[model samples]
Target chain A: MATTANSTKKFRHRVMSAALAAGVALAAPALAYADGRVVVFSPPSTDNYIAAWQSGLKKKAADLGYEASFIETTRDQSEQDAAVQQELAAGADTAGYIWWPFINAAGTNSLRSLSRTGKPVIFANQYPLEGTESLWTAYAGIDDFANAKTAAEMLLKACDESSTVKCDKGLIVTFPAGFSAGADRAKSFRETVDGKLEVLQEQPAGFTSQDGYKVGSQIIPPVKDDVTWVYTQNDSLASGIVQALTEVGKTPGKDVLVIGGTCHGDTSDLTSGHVIGTEVQGAYLEGWYTMQTLHRYLKTGVVKDGKVYAEATPDAPPSDEGDISRYNFIPSPPVGNSKEAVEGFRLWGWTMDELCNY
Target chain B: MSRREIFMDVMFRTGLMILVYVGFALFIPSYYSVRGVAALLDGAVVIGLTGLGIGVTMLAAEFDLSVGSLAALIGVVTLNFINGAEVGMVTAIVLGVVIAGVFGAAQGLVIAITGINSLVFTIGSLIGLRGLALFMSGENTVNIPVQRLEETDFLSASVLGIFSIPSLVMIGAFVLVAAFLRYTVWGKEVLAIGGGRTEARAAGVSIKRAMVVAFAISGALAGLAGAISCVKLGSATPLGFDTLLLSAVTACLIGGIALEGGRGTVTGIFVGLLTLRFLVGGVSGLGAPFWMQNLAVGSLLIVVIVAQLSVRQLKSRHDAPALPVH
Candidate 1:
């Protein structure tokens, strides 16, 4: 009797395993599908900011409906077109496209493709190239020029206040050639600091702390005496600048003022007082604004050609009284020092954890 | 080869390197300083190791275009393995280097058996492996925890205000690679195969084995280069390693390494790397734009290669017998 019972149990287990395998094989295609209403295309997650962006997006997306979907790709214009084409071929349920391109395709040629979609498309991370604003419904991201201007203000302030070092001589380390944000920031910083600050050197580097460290080690030794203030376009480079300065027996906050123009990853430099200051530019808030703007437009059915800057807070309703045609950027708020970045500093009612890091 | 011929080439390459060094030092006062010299070597560390590795693979008349992708992947994966997988740093680094070697050997085997062009095969690996790295890392920078930052310092910290662990490792790699290629039977076979595969095969050299070993060495060195860089930065991002491929190719060209095959010594590659680094360092030191630095390196590479070809042609004409008409 025991042998018969064991055989029956073994036969049932085999049947269950086979059934489970079949179910998974069938479900894979359904998992890949992104369609019917709002479609967001983003790069695959590599940093906490990306993860935070997705979370912020989903929280907003959940209120709208299940029709909101997300697709992951690191593609340019043609590839994005192909993806949209595939969606249409498979009985297109997508309402509109929210494209965060890996590269800036902000030109007349790309504008033609976005217009061809015949639906509202929101461009994020890059402002629409000037004179071609009519093609996209809305643009949303940090304003690179404004953020750099803020950085310039912060650096100039540091120079005015410091009794230890002359802020008159400065250098800027920016992202490698062809990166849009880096170019925009460098131009603005140089322009704002003209005559007021004697900008010594401006060089392009890869967007990593290692790149910062390498460039700083090679370039700083030559200009160490003259260069009292350094501005790295992003926070990662700022952290690396600290490492490089310390290695060469220089005190960063004391001897050289560091202005990490835009915040991104690793704020430990700020808390440790290695980096003197950086502006608040959070990915989470950027994501929230993109969805909120797109959602409002889908409801309002308007495209007024201009810029609509997202200000105040994350929970606040997007400024969609009419339609935003061109740009919507996140505000860049400056945090003075480590103490302020860690203590009671607030932007739009959110702490650094929520406004910057999250 | 005559003793004179060997001496002529060695002296010529060394002399050119010194000329460039002196020129840079004269223009940029900092180039004369110990710290400045160390900084120049610091710039060369990653590319120097990558260049030397590819220089070895070139001995067997094979190209490993996958070194850049392999370096980036191995570096990031090593750190990730240690931090995320909770393994000891040494074990993680060793595993990364070993995996890189095995991965390269697999590519070498495919090239040997199929007799496909190595450039094409390695390019495929280049794209595929980079994709794999991005997939693994989620397209982001992987950094060591803040507390671990101090641990990374000893690698870059100046020893007596001169040589750090990284610079030492780079020099050590050049010495070992030069010694290995000069002394070992397998190394001689690699050179022979590069000179003429059919002739080498007739002489009982195993082309397949030689290619495998050269690539394995190249891949292992690239891995170690990546490992050393990670130790210093305490972080890794998977893009930027492609720059090494261009730098390595240019270094080999400047070093008098023939793409057609068997020529040049590891010392020649070192000199080439030094010349390249000094040109770049001096340009940056002068506050010249970045494009000028690239232009200088390109000009140096072209000049050296053209000069080497001219020398070869002159020697061939000199050795030719009198014409029948004469």
Candidate 2:
């Protein structure tokens, strides 16, 4: 039995050598690891708010002497996982993954699978799920909670102007779904708006413009005049609400102020008339920083813990009590008054320099 | 053509269209206007183009569930190739059309060789083709560059002042197909085969060849419609044809194209498309919430179908001979 075991071990070693020989046979000229080809897996397409980030990342890749190609997976979690598998199958060695979780639950499992390859995994719009970051580099575009706080502040101001009391009666519409950022936004918005204001309605909009319209329209029918503002999670839903109000012959801003996030081009139309105020998600910067961090991690094993790579929560500070809540929280500049806000938004994102460096 | 036959056919289809349009108008206030009619026509042209192929295939007692997915695949593939090549818009469109024909031919081969039940086969084909498209496109939305396509004027511009060029093209295609199916020997064979394959075989018809030709033609037409739509949108999305299946099926059904096969018309399908368009336009123009419009369109389809079937049943009852006092 001992002799047989030894022989089996020898046979396995021989097979391993043969496989190595076959691999070398297939490729005589193995490109050096520094061939400077970085494969990027973007969960959302270049068309979404993330394009700014992609553009920045491209510039950064060029600076780093890395040619990069991005593949979008339409933010479908299962499909995104499949996409990662496809990329690995297509020979994307030394690849970096930048993901914006479509739903919160999907982020952990998907990232964990990718991290199993021991490649550098980067997060653009989401946080690391507990143990997942130990295997990968995690970075964010902006502080989701801070942006939500900014959005809430903007809404409060709008509500105060129309309200009879010092604090306005506000209705916050959000999704019940998971996603650290989405949940953070809703939680922060409630925390900021609560007690100071009369909460009129806080129904779910289901992360879609159609839902925003449906829920917004439903709420509009009942309120006589006390509802001072309508706050939504995104611009699409904001547009839906605005459309509903316009139908009822009531001017949005004049009757009640509306506020939402996503400083997209579409939101500009709504903000132009002071119909709504928005907190832009800095996608470009997020992309640039994500790639920058990964490149740094690849070159140097050191992960920059103190550096404010992206936004962190102010309410819940880091577990290490000595550490400050450090984050690269780039604030979305206010569009000023209703008249000036609509003139045109820059669609705030990372500059070319930031992207290429990352 | 006999005057009575032409009159009856036109009246039957046209009447069905008007009734559906009017019924929707009752629900949506804006549906009664000229703009609503125009909207219906625009939608009809887009959906009807594909529905025409479906209608034809239905008349032959077969189905092509892959039509929608195939259209999306062709649109995305053509746009990617065109954009990648930096080719002229005209050349791109031509290439798109040719590629579409090739895709159709591939599907035709499967049906011809396998002799599988088309309904089951097409369902599988639809899922597979859509998966292939999604994979190929990397799940990205491709903007159509509508302005560039619009410059062609002949194909993209509104013609005769009110009708869209694409819509006109769709109508022309319908007439051509209708004529070919009704007047040509091949057309007679298709009708005969659909009516009764056993009878057609007895008459010495080449069943496999005819069925293959019908499926191929259906697929090619769907591809053409998808390409044109992509050009209009200035972008192609994997979800571009998401509505294609439901709309095609609904339009075909409403056009009096029996799912059981051996009965339907190009004109009826065209009218059905128009009716759906008006229904959508009217509700949208009236400014209903986004989801409500979808709900209205869906429920309205069921109502319209039931109403038409009911009316046909009533007419049959009326035509029955009176019973004697036995």
Candidate 3:
């Protein structure tokens, strides 16, 4: 009687295991049928930043039942184009939407072309010039020119008031001043400084800190005493400028004020008083918004919100904000030294937990 | 002076001096002051030293493409030893030198034992060594703290009233190497071996030993060059000396060092390096478009190579028998 009972129990266990396996097999196809993917394209050199951004995007993508991957280009237009083409080709098979940090104008066109294929494309942290509006569904990034103006004003304020020195008449080591973004920063800076500042020297330091250091080390030592500011085109350049200045025995804030745009993680030196300020980009918020927009677009297939769609002109500019979004001219709040710099980080809209997602 | 000899010598010497002076003169006006020239010189020293290593190797009809990556590895090794540590700079430098020597010996062994072409072998090593550099740095930039060197008064201080210390070092290294090649017996043996390997061996020279020594010196010097550059830049990147191989090789070539080997002076190499320096300074100083520099270098290289090739062709033609008039 005992042997018969044991045999029946063993038979029941096998039946339950088989039923559970069958249930999973039946549901697997439905999971595979879900159309959810987010594509991020960034410069290969900015892999560190993209990696950090994607880690955050992945968490949200997972919670929302979506997929995300990133492609990195080495700052070359052709290389960037190759990355985009590869992603677009793959996206045709398994893509819900596309996201990109356009390396330049041509890259924007590539993104626009991809968007025409009925896929939502998000231009993250860079906007196209006029007449390039058919590019993407939405744009997410801080205004670069505003960041430049804020940097210029803060630099002028940091200079010695009694010295009769104009911060504008200092060396401007910037990126190659060819693109709309770099050109905008250069123009805004020149306008803010007015005639009081003379650009003694302006050279392209590329966008990397190493490039900035190479340009800065050569320009700083002999001119540091007379130069009131070592203006960089961006935050990474500013970090390099500071490192170069420090190497030459001139403390950054004490010897020469450093100012630039783009507050990537490298700007942590500002919190330690090693650098002055930079325009911080809200990377996390941008990533989250991208996923949210992509999800909605894939589900509803709508391009614009209700009333905005009615008022939209085909020729409307590709601005991150509309004419109604509070102040069409956004301010890149100054990331001053100390607590002010930390406050600048608040715009990222990421809790400490989310920020650590990278 | 004999007419034929004087013409040939004048052509050579004039070419050499003009190249050197023009190299410096072009930068003087644009830099606006002597101090700017001095700073430019500092950066040039690092390249110039590596050129010396390449110059010596080229003299022996052999090449070592691994020197570039080897330089970076040696630099990071030096930095790791010295960074925020109680170890003295001299001790760290010595360790770097020893390690570089050992690495060079291994390369020398491969070339000597396998009979494989140095070009292919070193190219493989170059890729492998670059990977090692990236792995060591965890693919991050390593910023060397200059404070210790600065505190010891060893780091380069103010640019001289007329020239910078690094530039001065470059000039001194060029002179020292020039003197060594011209005045030393070992230099003659190098020339003999390069001119004809069989002849050099028959003449009682230890060809294998000489080759090994040359490789060792080349590697050690390259290592030193990378370290100096790290000190100057205050940081080291995994990209390392790869960007500099072109400049170093070009300097050696334009300096009148023959690709066939055993045919150049260190002074000629100096002229070549200066020419490159001028190219960089002129384009950057004149605020010309950056792409123009590449064009300028390309044009200058073409002009030099054509001139040299033409001279060789003319000499061969002169040596040939004239056809008798029928």
| lDDT of candidate 1 over A232-288, digit per residue (tens) | 988888878888888777899889999898776767888877788888876776777
Best by lDDT: 1
Q: lDDT order of candidates, best first? A: 1, 2, 3
Model 2: per-residue lDDT, tens digit, A134-214? 545656456666667778787777655654323467677775333456666777877887777677876666555677778
DockQ of each: 0.02, 0.01, 0.01
lDDT of 1 at A89: 26
What's model 2's lDDT at A118? 72
Q: What would you estimate as the lDDT of candidate 2?
A: 0.62
- Local accuracy of candidate 3 as per-residue lDDT tens digits, B1-326: 24574356446745754664454443234243554555455546666888887888788777878888887877777777777554666676667777887787678667867878878988998899888886776544454443333432344455455455556666786787667666887766666777788988899976776677667767877787776555444445555566567768887776667787877666667767767665654443332333555677778777777888887788889989999999
lDDT score of residue A206 within candidate 3:
66
Interface RMSD, candidates in the order listed: 23.3, 21.9, 21.6
Off by over 4 Å in 2: A1-358, B1-13, B19-40, B144-156, B311-326
Q: Please list the C-alpha lDDT of all candidates, in the order they appear.
A: 0.72, 0.62, 0.61
Off by over 4 Å in 1: A1-37, A66-68, A74-91, A106-114, A131-135, A206-208, A266-268, A271-273, A313-322, B1-61, B66-326
Greater lDDT among 1 and 2 belongs to 1
TM-score of candidate 3 against the unseen true structure? 0.49
